[model samples]
Target: MATVILLRHGRTEANASGTLAGRTAGVHLDDLGRTQATRAGDRLAVVPLAELVSSPLERCKETARVVAARQARHDSVRPRVHSDKGLTECDYGEWQGRKLRELARSALWKTVQTNPSAATFPGGESLPQMQARAVDAVRRRDAAVGSAHGSDAVWLAVSHGDVIKSVIADALGMHLDLFQRIQVDPASISVIRYTDARPYVLATNSHEGDLSWLAPKHRRKRTRSRADQDAPVGGGAGPGTPA
Candidate 1:
């Protein structure tokens, strides 16, 4: 078992303007976004993260870099940013750069809002596929971290808002249609603990906290499995997989 810290990338110009950036390239964080990410990094600087995984999108990559830089300040080995396409922003297709207010008037908007499980973007992926990949990505990374670092390992996944919400829905055993109720804001922190029995949703959309308490406790001396002792300290193509 391990804890996966899901972080939404900071706000972008599209966010401030209420536009859907989707997977459009070159969308970087705004000034406020930078500040928000910096504060998030400072908040989690003391936590011992086993790995830093991020969406390949520029916004997520930038946020991951800031968090990793802060973690590097306290740890002997600097954390590396592992890109995962599975965590990328949902492909909004024709709505990639549309304003939300304008899109809200479209007939498809209602379906997206009320029944996301049945919604599919024109020329893009279906909602179910998006949720599937995002959930799988997080679960795969959680298992990898637990196997390599042990049950108490804490890791991070920097991704988009909808993707985080979908993963949160899965962790809570909620249906995809109801995932819309979970609002993930810019630079928010959501935590999920996966154990042998089930997943625990520790926190969601959290903007404030020391987070140092997430550090694994100092364990009493005990015999560890040979596999655990022989696990690689560090080595991987990336922390998570793509769809």
Candidate 2:
């Protein structure tokens, strides 16, 4: 099992303006977004991350860089950043660059809110498909990291709000339609660990908190008990000692 620290990219100009900038080009984080990213990076600086992954989108890449820099400040084993398209923002298609207020008026908006599993953006992807891809991407990455760095490894993924929310919903074992109940704000951190039994979500949408405890602790050596040391050499009653 390896832990994934899933983070949403910092707010962009479109995000502040309440627009759906889905798949839009050249949408970088705004000034406040930069500050938010820095704060998020600070929160996670103490964690010994094995990898830093991001959506290829500019906002996510920028946020990932900030987190990587903060982590590298003290940790000598700085992780290289990797990009995955499956972690990209939801394809809003015609809704791209549209205001949320206006989009909320559309009939599809109700579907998105009330029954996301049935919501499909025109000329784009369905909500279910989006969730599937995002979840798959995370699982694939987690497996790869676990194999490479061992079960205790910690990794980071910088993605979009919807993408992270969908992944969290899956981790929580919630249905696609219920995923709308999960909120993922910009620069927020969420955590999920894939175990042999099931996925465990340790945190979600955390804006501020102490994450230093997540850093790997040195394993303490086991001390031998007095009885064990005195009673036996290699078991088998130890030369007629108490059976």
Off by over 4 Å in 1: 219-243
lDDT of 1 by residue, 62-120 (tens): 99999998888877557999999999999989988999999999999999999999999
lDDT of 2 by residue, 90-162 (tens): 9988999899999999999999999999999998999899999999999998988877776667899999988
Q: Ten residues in a row with the worst lDDT in model 1?
A: 234-243
Q: Candidate 1 vs. truth: CA RMSD?
A: 8.2
Q: What is the TM-score of each candidate against the true structure?
A: 0.89, 0.88
Candidate closest to the true structure, highest lDDT = 1
**Candidate 2 positional error at 80, Å:** 1.8
Clashing pairs in 2: none
